[model samples]
Target: MQNQGLLKELIQSLCCLPGVGPKSAQRMAFHLLQRNRDGGMQLSKMLARAVNEIGHCRECRTLTETELCEVCANPLRDAETLCVVESPADVWVIDQATTFKGKYFVLHGRLSPLDGIGPDQLGFELLEQRMATGQIKELILATNSTVEGQATAHFIGEVAGKFNIRATRIAHGVPMGGELEFIDSGTLAHAFNGRREF
Candidate 1:
């Protein structure tokens, strides 16, 4: 029975992943043990290696295997402009979608006081130290549109302002090709308010 021994342990272990329930984990365990043992072994090895070796970048706090992330090490990237984001995943998304040549600072999460997450937890001390260096000319707040994200951006903006560095927030709105009729009201309103002269 899956509840009795190693199968139970495997299922419980897989359930640690986001969105993976007992049933889903059980299915995955069964699939791996039955038809894809080699693939499962590969996955296990890779996962272990990634977990053990991957670490936060020294400068930007993004996931990396070295002292600094590729962006931070690259000479071509603009060091004067830095994009601040909520997570390491945000860095990947922004890099692939935009032509921005600026450097990045991964916050890893926004401010959420209720949950006891503060600037210290999100590496704001490091960010402040970077700002104190005066190498950065602009701080781009690319945080999410949520209330917590907005508050986090504002807090960082204030910090940048104290150092005379310009801070700008990323514009939020509807998708590029989305029709107004199908778009959600909140996004539509935000888009209208953010509109500028073409």
Candidate 2:
């Protein structure tokens, strides 16, 4: 006998999520069907709402439900300094990890020629426009340590230079709890280069 169409479809759909394989999807489907129907329904509703309502902020490109995100709308944030990051997740991480009081410009993604993402796709024109306004005096490149991230940062630094804005990169080093043996060579080099005088 064939499996029920609705149950089979649910399992297949669940597999579309990241890291959810066929077995995991099947387990989740059965769990929801057997014991978590209410939670599953709520999750479905919320997911649909987020997908439909959330969009990139007009200024920073972070995910938001309004035209401007809370950060962009805040008047207290330093307009003269802008921190550039790859994604909204990076924005959250920086907000939690440091006392950065400046504004942000989220690139949304890095320069990946293979994936067809470039400066235009990452909203470089908008960033240039903001810089052209002469409000931003410094740009902090906070992209990741990957090659693509470094390339993106270099591109932004060049763009900032064109507008005569000072550009800087976030310092890369060993994490507080990271052991030197476990640290990568590139990170060690960066830490050495970025060492401060005692």
Candidate 3:
């Protein structure tokens, strides 16, 4: 609590970031100010650059500096399949597993009635448009296994039949409440292989 107003403000702002509570924010602020002044400057610069340069990918809604994410732009990826995810982070996690080789369609969020997030908020219209292209044969719903994630996937599956696109959900080899990023490579691969019709 004994710090300049600017330092206090920085700690308060840092606390607003996801997973950074007050205690962690305070420790981070102290470390940046006391021992890592140069690193702090670098962090600030990088954060500014990322904030300014990054935008949603046009195709998948993934975070990208360009119109399309690298995954969508890659030629070797399977064009006939589209893996739907909740966020750009999921794309990164799946990419690390190296189990999927298809293009992605990021929902950017799930339908959480408690949070006021609905189908429209998750870009269901864009998904419909992508399916309209008729190139994608499979629509894999790779959302988490949380209650909200399940609800979102179910809703997507309901609408997918209209387009006649084969809709599937990644198997629940992933633990309940476990995010795709935390699952091991083997589990992720198993989940991908064991995917079932949604």
Cα lDDT, all candidates: 0.95, 0.94, 0.89
Most lDDT-accurate candidate = 1
- Count of backbone collisions within predicted model 3: 0
**Candidate 3 per-residue C-alpha lDDT over 1-198 given as tens digits, one digit per residue, 9 for 90 to 100:** 466799789989998789999899999999988999999999899999999999998888899999988988999999999999998889999989868899999998899888888878888889999898899899899999788888888988878888889999886787779999999987899789987789
Supply the global lDDT for candidate 2. Answer: 0.94
Off by over 4 Å in 1: 1-3
| Best first by lDDT, ranked | 1, 2, 3
Better of 1 and 3 by lDDT: 1
- Candidate 1 lDDT over residue span 39-69, tens digit each: 9999999999999999999999999999989
Write candidate 2's Cα lDDT for 104-156 as tens digits.
99998999999999899999989999999999999999999899999999989
Model 1's alpha-carbon lDDT is 0.95
**Candidate achieving higher TM-score, 2 or 3:** 2
- Locate the minimum summed-lDDT window of 10 residues in model 2: 1-10
Q: Comparing candidate 1 with candidate 2, which one achieves the higher TM-score?
A: 1
Spell out the clash pairs found in candidate 2.
Answer: none
Q: For each candidate, how many residue pairs have backbone atoms clashing (under 3 Å)?
A: 0, 0, 0
For lDDT, candidate 1 versus 2, the one ahead is 1
